[model samples]
Target: MPAPLIWLGAACLGLYASNKANVAYLKHHDIVDAMPGESDQKSIPVNGSIVTCGIYGVLDHTGIWYENTIYELSGKGLVRCVSPERFLGNRSGTHIYVACKPNNKVLANCLAANRARKQLFTLLDYHLFDQNCHRFVAEMLVNHEVAVTSFSDLNTFLSEFFDVPIKWNRALVKK
Candidate 1:
């Protein structure tokens, strides 16, 4: 076989194996898979729900849902409230996903929302691996400082907070 073909095949196999491992992990933890491309009905986010949107189809940007608005930390480090359109703007996907229970009911924490509201317009030293959106959202949910580098970490925190399996509900909250 050609060298290029062999390399491509190896990469494909590695991706498949990685996906399988991730699926098994989620299932063992009672967590739902909510990666982009999954079919989900559009709904509105409830206050205090942890919401996320895909970025470049490879990453997810997280925020807190409150009063029909999303509180997110911009890359520039400013925490601000944004409409759903703004949240999804210039992103790879159009739908926003919220944390939910197995019954599809949205899970929320008012204290988290309050924390996010209080932190509005606050500036932080945004570090992609540390004080980024995932960490910000996780801290709001937990009402304490935490280290969350990705959606999986945030979901783990939320699952423990609500004591329920976390699923993602696709929502499109409008102004």
Candidate 2:
């Protein structure tokens, strides 16, 4: 009947709904539609100097994908490929890119939150944890697939992903 207990209860209820919605969303439009299968979305090829795959629309399918390639199309229709990682963060000039698979959708909200925080850490350039700290997040983000939006939502993701904190430095990752 204490204040903390009431707050905790409300928080739990909210999380339950958030989790449910996230799962429902992943199913509704198929966040992992990029994976090859019967539920696959669609891929279009850009006719340039070479063959390249493009996911149409403002595809919210964001996650920790590898540094595949970055392409630039000139008015002349000339296409060039580079590294998506080093050049991504696109409009912001520093947005981290991610990719998720069928299972990557598992990170729908949990890991998405963590990776975003990890990014915020880097953006602020704080060495609060070890240099290798980001690697743990990177591992989770690249966990076969993930879709984090920014570098400021880590704490929320931590609660969303794991019910407990098993790491030492993890506490520092929180606000």
* Deviating ranges (above 4 Å) for candidate 2: 33-175
Residue 27 error, candidate 1, Å = 2.6
Q: TM-score for candidate 2, please give it.
A: 0.26
Which candidate should be chosen as best, given lDDT against the real structure? Answer: 1
Candidate 1 has what TM-score?
A: 0.83
Q: Where does model 1 exceed 4 Å of error?
A: 1-23, 33-42
Give the lDDT of residue 158 in candidate 1: 75
Instruction: Return the top candidate by TM-score.
Output: 1
In the range 1-175, model 1's lDDT, one tens digit per residue, is: 5999999779767856665576567758786544434537455677888889888555679998888889999999999999888999988877888877777788888888999999999999998878899999888877778877776677777778788877787876665
For all candidates in order, the CA lDDT equals 0.80, 0.30
RMSD of 1: 4.2
